[model samples]
Target: MSSHSKSLGEFDLIERFFKTGANSLRTTADSAIALGIGDDCALIRPPADEEIAITSDMLVEGRHFFAGADPELLGRKALAVNLSDLAAMGAKPLGFTLAIALPMVDKIWLEAFSKGLFAASYDYSCPLIGGDTTAGPLTISITAFGSSPTGKAIRRSGAKAGDDIWVSGTVGDARLALAALRHELNLPNADLQNIAHRMHQPTPRIELGIQLRGIASAALDVSDGLLGDLRHILKQSQVDAEIQLNQLPKSITLQKQGIGIQNQFAASGGDDYELCFTAPSTQREKIHTISKILNLPLTLIGKILPKKDVEVRIHLLDASGIELSNSEAAPFLNSFDHFAS
Candidate 1:
């Protein structure tokens, strides 16, 4: 042992106390980490002829996630959520950094979390390039990086008044999962288990995002609920949409549960991890075709409209094939105002 060795102390709290950055066991992408650990700054090279896309997030205990959450899943989810942002920009996966704070070193928890981190990181081919660790409330802040050919990246400002809007996957899974966790709703054991999985393991649609680079006029991830996230695109594109209520992808179980459509669970409840995008009406078939090839379902839910602000028109049909709207039937979206205390 070296003379510089310091006692870890009981509870290993001393070492954890001094470990003021990402733990040493983190998978370090040594090649790109030209100046790792103890360095003032880090440097990396971008892909040739491509522009870099960057996104970050802070996963805080009690705020962003639960305190009793499994550490391994937390590690994976922290990365997945950030990558979803990069995916929305139609960028290829590159790498990420983690800054984790923990109250104490629990080997079991750390091992499980490290396993999850490495599993997902390697699966996505995104290496853990670098980061710092510290002693504080349990929190994991991740910063992800990606690159796309210059001028090929997707943005939230390309929708036109006549464009069609689409979404991948269903909505309300995460919020429903949270509800299950809280026992606010007594669902079947199998159902609750499924929801829990979605909450813990969100799959970011990176490949689909890449494929939609040229096809989608605008795109964003449905993280903060469909309505809230869609509003971001609407505002950026300076357009409005009349999304059909019945066209939304609701889980069959969610439907059988008789969860009222008025809840707009597909619209107001968020964290679905789906991609909502817009394309010319002519491209609708193209979108579905690619979806078939990719084995990912993409649904055409509505059309962009000429309006001053974003307004959703739910359930647009009658016996005579005329548009219809009722206070109880048309559960419009109010993402910004929903669940605001």
Candidate 2:
């Protein structure tokens, strides 16, 4: 691949693989895109009366994923993580721009990666508008564009003292897969395969986010971990929260693990891209109905609390309603930090 890469100029690489793949994924949003690839820049017009929500995510080899991970899944995840950011804001995906640095232009890898990337673009109705290609370490960065009704995007600062905290789908499976892959834990091969997709191809809760508009008071995607990410809302809203450790939703595979494993991973699993949100207690019935409508489980795991004159932002509780001490909950309190050593 490296030898052949010498013959593949950057322009030729983009035109043959990326641009062609992107053109095939164009959607109705094309009308809003005044100019796409083959130009200095891509121009897109956000829908009238809507505000654009933009987000960018970058993945680097050996940092975000293994050095020789599947290119197809990596491609899907590159855009999916960015789309999850849009979903966090209750926005509809419009388009995306990808900036990728390749160690070498491998045709086979490019074909598989482009297939997965464009597949996700079509699935979310987000076409590839424009981007740049370069030569460097294997890294992919995607900036996604989305739109939401003016002033209606859900935010982390909207949680009130009495709001009910909820989470969409389940958590912990991604981290479980990681632990097994790293040999930190052992699992049946079948079970590992079952949960591996949660780590590789996360589903962006875009539809649920759109439906949460005006319903959810505050929301964010659980990328960094459930307990750690929830602190963002508490800090922003100047509120506190109490969550039942046992109430966190987990997949059947994850449930097979011990309680300690469940609590640690479910509370602090970093890559689960599910939606954790807050809504009024009065809207519990409504949220339940929406869960049924979407065929997604909406679990009520906690409640918001009025801010007390204390440093703690949230408390973890056992089934007996006893709050765990800071030391007892210490392991689950920290979120994933990219630069932490």
Candidate 3:
């Protein structure tokens, strides 16, 4: 495969593999894309009354995935994470551009990767309009475009004191998968596969985000650890929060773990891709209705509080709703830091 791919020029590679996939993504007559691949630049026409929401994410080999990881899964995840960003903003996906760097053009690898990429594109109605493929270390960077009603896009600064803090779907399973893969933990094969799927293929809550437009005050998807990502909201909103450690929604697989493991992973694990949002307490019933309508679990874990002295504190609480001391909360505060040694 490598020998055959080596004979193919870069332009030929693009035309043979990625171009067809991009062309097929223009299945909708009302697609925002005016032109796709083989152009100097892709054209788009967004509705005048709507605002464009764009996000980009880069996945580097070794840093983001294991060497020799399934290219198909990698392809899906590269796009899924970007879509998750759109979901965070309560926007509907329109299209995307992919810029990929490859060590070599392996036809087998390209086939699987393109399959996965187009699957997500078709599922989310996010067409691939343009991209650049170059020779380098394997890396995928995707920039996704979405649209939302003007003035209706959710922001991190809108969370107010007295708002209820909520999270959609479960957390921590992905961390458990990572731990097991790194040999930091041991697990049954069944459990490992289940949790690993969560780590590799995350579902972006696009519909939920769209429905929460007027209801949620502030929202973001959990890619970094929940606490760390939620801090962005706190800092922007200038508010504090108290979260019940036990109230964090977890998969049954995660719940079976020890208390310390549960707390650590659920609070600080990255790549959950679930939604963490804030809404007024008065909308609790409406939130519940949305949850049922979407058939997704929405857990209320905390409340926004008035910021004191410009310090945005995240008070950790026990199952009984008693606040824990700094000493007791210290262990659960550690989150993934890219530059940390």
Q: Once model 1 is optimally superposed onto the true structure by TM-score, how far is the C-alpha of residue 335 displaced, in angstroms?
A: 3.4
> Model 2 — which ten-residue stretch has the worst lDDT?
1-10
**TM per prediction:** 0.83, 0.95, 0.95
* Deviation in Å, model 1, residue 294 alpha carbon: 1.6
Index of the highest-lDDT prediction: 2
Q: Could you give the C-alpha RMSD of every candidate to the true structure, in order shown? A: 4.9, 3.0, 3.2
lDDT of 2 at 53: 94
Displacement of the residue 92 alpha carbon in candidate 3, Å? 0.3
> Model 3 over residues 181-211: C-alpha lDDT tens digits?
8888888888897788889899999999999
Please provide, for model 2 over 1-341, each residue's C-alpha lDDT reduced to its tens digit, 9 standing for 90 to 100. Answer: 11133344654655567878778876887777777777777888988999999999889888888888998998999899999999999999988998888888788898889888998998989989887777789989899999999999999999999999999999999999988998989999999999999999999999999999999999999998999999999988889999999999999999999999998999998899999999999998889998999999999999999999766378899999999998999888878653233
- The alpha-carbon deviation from the true structure for residue 289 of candidate 2, after best TM-score superposition, in angstroms, is 1.2
Residue 67 accuracy (lDDT) in model 1:
72
Model 2 TM-score on a 0 to 1 scale: 0.95
User: In angstroms, how far off is 109's CA in candidate 1?
Assistant: 1.9
C-alpha lDDT of all candidate models, in order: 0.72, 0.89, 0.87
Error of 1 at 276 (Å): 0.7
Clashes in predicted model 2: 0
- Between candidates 1 and 3, the lDDT winner: 3
